[model samples]
Target chain A: MKDWKGKNLIFIGGGIAMPPIRCAIWYALENRADYGNITIVYGARTVGDLVFVDELDQWAQKERTSVIQCVDPGGETPEWKHEIGLIPHVIERSNIPAENSVALVVGPPIMIRFTLPVLDKMGMAKKDIYTSLENRMKCGIGKCGRCNCGPVYVCKEGPIFSFEQLSQLPSDY
Target chain B: MSDVIAKDDLLRLVDQWLAEGKRVLGPVKAGDGVILYAPLAASSQLVLEGFVHAANSIKEAVFPRSETIYTYKFNGHEIELSDVDPDSTQCIVIGARPCDAASLPVLDHLFNWDYKDKFYNARRAATTVVTVACSEYDDNCFCTSVGLGPAAEQGSDAMLLKAPDGWYEVRAVTDKGTALFNGKTTPAPEIKVPISDGPAKKFDTVDIETFLKNNYESDAWRDITMRCLGCGACAYNCPTCHCFDIVDEGDAAGGRRVKNWDSCQFGQFTVHASGHNPRAVQAQRQRQRIQHKFRIYPEKFGAILCTGCGTCTRNCPVSLGVLNTLEAIAAVARGSIEVK
Candidate 1:
């Protein structure tokens, strides 16, 4: 993230995956001048499933920040002002600029699986797309040995990995 | 010329160490015809022969099956926590197999890799390993395949090789060894203990590694490991399988947080709280054990996690140890077996 100065920072998060994405957005917005633009495409099963609703509105009010909220089809209510579709389809229709941008995606496996191709088609480099992973972990250090994806132990090496880094590992996790 | 110690003198030395309060661990005959590496209550309890290998490795010297890391006590709206002191008893592990001794160095990397484990390091510092060179090996022994041998001095402080007529040739490889046996050996220039060439190379490590690197999705994993009962006997008995679980065994009153040995072969080893399991099936778990020992650990720590001890196979209920799996992988790499 530090290497890509002035690059557009795009955050895509699904239900209950907002904490990490929310963290990155807060840091980027805290130093808004250091980045080019900030875009948050957040979705859940329904509006009731969304979190930090007021904070999302607050972030949308900030300069150069755009917050897009959505829900799955048929999950929206009568007053639903946002889009209605799966996260990947909504992202495709959002015209999110992939050039000179780093995307941080967080969600369940299904959300990640469908969103990657959309980001790729939008011209996001694999190295620029990051996601955090979770595995059964006991000792947060590397010794316990259960959290490994391949040669790397997620506890010590990372829970956050770029698509480029993750692609090299066996799909064990 | 070799420094020789009579078998009687060696047993006496063990008695002397026990009298001096140093913990002496060696292979002992447990009931039911099982020989295990256990703490010696007396020198007479040590079993010197008739066992190909102890049922357990000497890993318990540094990494015990279960240990308390810390304790907690609940106070009025507060909690009091106390750290457990790691056992620092001056310890000597005598009569360890060369394969068992070699696991120490391999394990050292994991304990000290980035976050230094104080407990493991403290015990390791206090323990000195005395290995006995194997004059005999069984079909399960494959130390040679993994670049180790019967008399390999990788982690032994001192080594004992069988000599003529109830004597052992003492070879001290470290200062610790020299100090322990400083005045215990008699010089016998004419005696040379013949060492057995360890078990024949069972599988090529390079070929096995190559196959593992390429065959993550192969159907061979399912076929090869179909009979694995997931009993985890192989892991529990393995010298280098160091996975563990940390649990807090307490309620509102407070209790201790302990670390216990865990096994990859267990179905719950990699299950997430959300009920998503990465390596969901038995085959995947078996593949993980092999890949971890051969490829992943070596790639990360520059050492193979296995010493080719073969205890896993010897203890495995289904006869599906790493050797059998690796041999199958080797055949697959050589194109002798086809996987759809």
Candidate 2:
């Protein structure tokens, strides 16, 4: 209830779901004084799939925030010196403190499925974790019935849902 | 006071509408035991007979299958964009079934929710829907199960009930309906229409809605959707299934943006750009279809997204009906099985 000023911001983004998180990253940097310690753990199938490289570098260079990048095994290049594995494995190994942290993750479905459990083990409650669903939506409004999860239209009700909220919906998507 | 118009007088109304150069769409005989809404030029063409409702609902009267929301033109170097205005032309829609008529208000809640869809709103404003009460029943019709009736005039401007002796009782329900009278009526008090006998309620929706939420992770989804072809014939023909995709057609310089009907039944509906599909299989898609109508839409809109029109089952190749799906959920609600 103390607002986001003191909350540690963790954004786990990779692949195509990176843009929205990158937008959030820029917002956090612009209003950096409004937030606390920021950590971004991002990964991909390969270094080539990594998005927002410039921004990632900028975050890594920031004095307060930490940016950890990773690539799947055998996907590392000669220039790559970071961790080699899935993002959750990297974060678990990096040992970032989970106290007072609210993490927003956006990535492939498999990545989300694996990453959330890792965050849970780090002491993050289901309510503290958030992800958006782009569930095959149409009519961005609720009129179109395509992107629904257990009576919730992902387009109108969410492009965003917390882990606790996701648990309440049907597991169709 | 309400009055009755002769069945012949109704035809004269259609003729007058056609003479006025206004868009008149009504049910016409499509084939044996089938009727579809189409442009009407003659009163003789209206087929307010047989079937629970027309093969298609009155949805397209407001939200079309595809329409240009914005038009963009590129001339050599410069590009100009124009906004498509809501249709202002007078349009009269006659012979919509009670369930189909009820769909307009159901759709109103959604089109107006989150953001107002002006394209749909415009057509809704321009069109006056007149519905016929049902006197027949089909195996697929189930409006009663979802809180609507065979003769419920929830969205109609005019109510046309077929009575004995070839007489049609026309009750003007709204200002638009009243305006159709133009201050003329031959009050025929003897006109009486026996209430329409609607199809039996297949399953209770309240029980189904509750049971569906708790069984999201259940395996019953796979068994129910195993034979699904994902043809999307249901979504397309449904009066309340209003999913649409916005696409930019043409070239990079300038292209017109169009909204086309999209379906949850397709695999591409939830595929990410990284080639990952969350609802990767038919069971998931089928789960999405059921939960949307029974559970999700109700939570947000306070109404079921289905009219129980059964157009989907009627058109589906596999004969996979929504009634069967609802019954399956009802079975779960009765505690016979957990749907797991």
Candidate 3:
């Protein structure tokens, strides 16, 4: 793993994936010295679809952190200044430096499917890119036997995985 | 303290337990071809022959299919909640198959993981399962492959092996098992534990587990796919499959919460309120069923989830048997089948 103290923590996500990555943001803030620059690149289909509105505003001002919020290109308003488009294009415009850094993407399947390759294209190693998965689960624990991604149970093994780890999983989701 | 008893004496033991004011449950012929573990009103209702297994497992006696978790009532200005207590029910499961009895301990590990499921645990505490060795075996039986046999006694309180004669060779496997028959037995001929010749021990599942772990995109899955009617019979009839859904029933302000049996085969199973469905296709749903039983579960808990009872195959509308799929996967792992 890259050194979080000097490396950038880039969060590229949207929709329901907001809260969990936001959780990581709060966590990094709790231990500011161990982490470097934290950038959150969030998007939604529309403006109202955004979540944790006040927290986003709060993190926007926090030191060593940057918050980039966007909606679909068509969702742009007259007052909006931030680039509005698909998250990957907007992230490409941000000129993110992938060296010695890790990128976390938490979003719908389409967002994950599109965003991860873009990071890969930008020279992010398979190990440095991570994503969260969603599945139907009867038991939050490993019991009721649903929430499986191939041989791995999403409930127990993970709802989280690195790009390299996910490549080894069956594409059931 | 001799432990073996004749069939007549076993029936008498049931009669005695009933006389002692305890509920006795056993597999009874439910219909023309159906058999179920039901509460026995008379000793004659107990059907110990035909090792083809019952229509249901002994799980429902403890974890019922559909049960009201709690009730809520309208009090003048506000609604009140009432939690159901699990200390009242007492039951004895008679004539459980070794596989059926074994599923309880598997369920026990799950229900008591981090947060104890009080209702299941309470009923588990109150119930004593009595498993009987098989007198026969069918083509679909595979209890031996998953590390259990007709006489394997992992979860039985008391195990009774049927001798060539009408009597059963009894042995206690636990403290509760010993308590089931303390002074009720007579000295009899010593017998070896009987093993079922069903579920030929030839089908090795080790390679299948490893293959599934390494190859997520194995074409073996497509080969096993048949035209499924999407009915939940496989999960519904399975002894080890216990997925459930919590639903609110009754009127507003005075409704009760219920736990209903759920199946992963349903399209609505993985759908989100935000209109996102992860497993939107039938193949994904079907894959989950196999992975849960053979792969995900064993890797995490070190116990094969499927008891190889063949209930899923017997209940499948499309004749998509689990054993065939497993064998095919094993073949793929062995390099017998070329990956496409």
Candidate 4:
């Protein structure tokens, strides 16, 4: 319930990390009176693999926040009224203003890579986009040298960094 | 800061530091004409008269090759996790080459930006670097091209220069270095040095971004990378090549989380569980390696990631040096194709 007034946050992918992202989203939702719109654009390879479907449905039902679910058109799923396509396609069609939006992109590197250009086309600066990096985090505090991308260790320095920071590294992550 | 420390007093300084119950890590011969940063038990252990850079950078002292991140235990179908200890130790790295020391700050920028990493930061904070100037430059060396020189002091707390009459000129650059000079440290004698202009080898990385963008799919990579063995010796030895992976291991009862080194040359680097890979070919992987260093990193930090240390060129099994790659790409962009 900490004040997030006038802040627009979005999460663009769904994986095992969805529950944690939901917890973060709900934390923002509790203070909707103080925060701006919170949107979760959950994309999965198929409808079945999309975890937390029921919970997201409940949130969308009460209109606590907006949820956009995109699945492969060929993938099986019960009838769902959300968008069906790639997450990047959904993002482009959602008409979200990139200038005022702070996106938290977490997924495989390929998915993260595909979403960046769309955000860039939507006018989001590299600094406005944050993504968590996964590496060999031998020492979470940055000593083991396993999780370092360049100057940053994904574990200690960040599991989170602006795309700008990641762009500086040699893609070791 | 105070006056410099003379070369002759180097051993006396080490003796004093050891007497004070402090440890000193310096370059020592480790066989196969290689040098490693190891503990100095005596003044003879220090190789001050050498012109070669250490085979490996001193990153291992701060970030070890392997360490436990967290421990976990399984109970029936459930699992529990426990935290590992943070690494914090005081030490001194002596006789680091200018190129190696200079890489520290660039590495620091990424590790300390958002979340503070205590592991590497703790060692970086606790460790005091003493860099030595390189008296000789080889064909593979390109420190001058990347804003670092054989004599650069980019990341040192104190710098050591070899002067005539077997004397060394040491300058303290940081508060930590100044503190080292205040207690039990004496000024080093000055030595005469010759004025020199231009390096033995020079490179112009101007407009590298545009050059790389235009040559992304050029045949130069395929032509040059044919001899590559896919071994990551270059990355493992390069001072600035930092990449790793994390994994959890143990039985159903308990296990530990560990982090270990990984390389872009591996087949699984960009592999996904769903059987998709972006850099499945050697050509793409090589491109990823070079672009990340020259194009991407420069665009991010406003500086090139490669320090031109030449470690990669020297250590590669088939000698797929980054210099050749840079030259090839640049040549192609300039409307020519050449590898020499």
Candidate 5:
């Protein structure tokens, strides 16, 4: 993220996967001058399931930042003004710019699976899209030998990887 | 000229080390016609010959099967953690096979790779390995396959080869070995101990590695490893299988965090809390073991994770050790066998 100065940072997260995305947003916002426009597209199954409600409102009002919050089709309430759809579908409807933009995505496996092709179709290069992986890690180092996708240990080499890097690994995880 | 020590003298040296309060481990004839590396109480308990390889590797000297890393105690509002001192008693491993000795250096890379394991490092530093070169081998022995042989010395502080007339030709490899045998050996320029040309190369490691890299999704894994019972006997007996698990054992009051030897062959090894298992089947687990040893470890650490000791094959319940598996893989690679 530090390497991509003056580039737009798009964060897409789904239910319970907001922590890492939140962290990256904090980093980008703290160093506001270092990055270009920041966009956050976060969603949950229902309005009650959504996290950081106050923070989302606070971020939306910040200069050069936009927050798009949503819920599943039946999950919206009467007072809800945000979008209504699955996270991937919501991201598709958002019409996010892919040029000179990096996407950081975090979500459940199904959400990630559906969201990846959406970003790809939006003209985002595989290298510009990143995600975190989790495996049954024991040692948290490479020695325990359980957490690996081919030669790469998710604990050691990465819990974070670019889509391009993930493509090179076997789908063991 | 080669330094020689009589068999009697070597046993006497073992006694001397034991008397000096050093932990001495060597091969002994355990009951039921089994040979294992165990702590020697006296020199007479040491079994110098009559086995190709011990049932277990000498790895327990440094990495025990289970060890307490730290103990935690809980108070009303605070917790107290106590660190266990890694045993640093001066230790000697006598009569270890060359394959067993070689695993030490291979393991050294892992214990110190990124986060230096203080427990492993401390014990490793205090231990000295004395290897006995192979004079005989059985069908299961394949040290030659992986670029190691009968007398190949990689991690031995000193190596002892069987010489004629009840004497051992001692080759001091490190300063510790030299110091141990200082003024104890008699120079014998006339005698030479003959070493065996280890097991024939079963399969090329490069070919195995290439096949592993290219054929991740092949049906050959399921076909070749169908009979593997997932017993993990192979991993337990392997000289270089270093996978382990860390667990906190106790109630709410708190207990000790322990590291225990783990195997990739186990079904629960890679199961996530969410009930998803990546390597879900026995074939996938078998493939993981081979890939880790042949391709992954070598690529990451620049050293293969196998010593080709054949201990896994020798100890496997079914006949499917690494050698058999690799042979099948070689057959697959050559198109001699087809997986439908």
Candidate 6:
């Protein structure tokens, strides 16, 4: 509800999280003028596994949203021109500046680990990259110790966190 | 005068509370030596001398294991959202163990810290916690080591202590508890013997952090967690272990996103939709479970998220108690390589 007005947002990673991320993105893109340009670079193992494919295409048609789907090599796909390489390579080839743009990373843990270094390579400091973790959470509130990744419950302190915050915690996270 | 209540008088007070329409729930003897918390309709329902902690914590009465948070409907292309308000009944939880009551305050910090979680805070605000001190101890019990006493003021608004000759010491520590005896009250009964407070139980958790940090790739994890079935019983039964999953269930016309308790021990917890799981192996999941409680929780919240309540130990299908895990790590820290 706050003025996300004038912030360029990008979501990297694809999964069950994609729908929720898209839900939030749609909310932002609805207020596009309020929220600056929105772009989503979604990565998955294959094109068959991409979530919200049609929805992403429709949003990109309006130019209010742009989506790049990354698939593994030799993965099944119908020819639609988008970023075709792995996530890190796509980021390297694409000229998306990391200085001011907010990037949301949501994917498997290995993807999370691999992407952080790319952000580091691009000189993207921790704060600019936001990621959401899906730890086994029961109580969205912190009372249940189930979602604990140390001091923060992934449910309460965040399903959303910065790379800087994640870096400080123990590696088990 | 305000501290002591005879056994009959104590029962009458509970009856009076229930008579005044307050919901009273206490520990009940469930099947197979399991103690569960349920509504106590009569004085005889109270278990004044139970040993182990309840099968589940009193948190369920407040923060249920599963509850709907919100509902969303897709109408054509637009979406409509609705809020889920928690139940607004005043409930009293009696016969809560010391560890169970103590664990609530630790949970309060994250619930009310940044964003105001109305669901948790609402139930917490409405409910009065009555903690019963432990008369017996187990080797797995470590409440004393973690800044808690057998009879401690961790989270109880009012604490009930059983004294000799069928007398109970009723001490009011919070305003709501004090208000229970505001008007013209009957005189408190005298006790025959002073309450017994036991010595602190000691365990060497002294380098738990260092051990975990240094032994990231140790084979000990695999050996210890080999018997884990990943059933999540340990998480489900714990008093302080609160993790959850939010899922949207329903048709396009209307549906609800309900949150249910989740466990890190399960492979599905961190599995992406692409069918790739981060913690596919149980060792990684087991490591996560331990570090999250000991190292990570303290790192973020300045308090270890465990009360050493031994619920996990008592209920584990494989007998891989978290206490033994900590002890193993501490033993390794002390340079003992003998595998248990």
Scored on chain A only, each candidate's TM-score is 0.93, 0.93, 0.89, 0.86, 0.94, 0.85
Give the per-residue lDDT of model 1 (tens digit) for B1-340. Answer: 7999999999999999999999999999889979999999999999887788999999999999999999999998999999999999999999999999999999999999889999999999999999999988998999999999999999999999988799999999999999999999999999998888888889888888888888889999998899999999999899999999999999989999999999999999999777878889999999999999999999988999999989999999889898888888888778888876
lDDT of 5 by residue, A26-140 (tens): 9999999999899999999999999988999999998899999999999999999999999999989897888999999887766776888899999999999998776889889
- List the candidates' TM-scores in order: 0.95, 0.90, 0.85, 0.68, 0.92, 0.74
User: Candidate 5's C-alpha lDDT?
Assistant: 0.91
Residues B133-221 of candidate 4: C-alpha lDDT, one tens digit per residue: 78776678887777777677788888776666666666778888767756544554434443333255555777556776666666777
- Tell me, by TM-score, which candidate is best: 1
Which runs of model 3 end up more than 4 angstroms from their true locations? A1-7, A16-38, A47-69, A73-84, A100-104, A123-130, A137-139, A150-173, B72-81, B190-199, B331-340
Note the Cα lDDT for every prediction shown.
0.91, 0.80, 0.78, 0.71, 0.91, 0.73
Q: What is the lDDT of residue B272 in candidate 6?
A: 45
The predicted structure with the larger TM-score, 1 or 3, is: 1
Docking class of 2: medium
Query: What digit string (tens of lDDT, one per residue) describes model 3 on residues A90-122?
Result: 887887878877888998887887888889888
The TM-score that candidate 1 achieves is 0.95
Best model number under lDDT: 1
List, residue by residue over B266-310, the lDDT tens digit for candidate 2: 888877566767788988888877887787777777878888878
CAPRI class assigned to model 4:
incorrect
Q: What are the per-residue Cα lDDT tens digits for candidate 4 across A1-173?
A: 24335767777765555866776777776766765667788878777778988888786764536878888677645776667887788889998856566788887776777887788788888887888765544435543333445445466568887888877655554
Better of 1 and 3 by lDDT: 1
- Give lDDT tens digits, candidate 6, residues A1-173: 25334667777875455876776777777766776567788876677778778887787786656777777666657774565767877777777666556778887666777777787778777877888776654455565455555556677678788889988664444
Model 6 stretches with alpha carbons more than 4 Å out: A1-173, B71-80, B181-200, B204-206, B213-217, B338-340
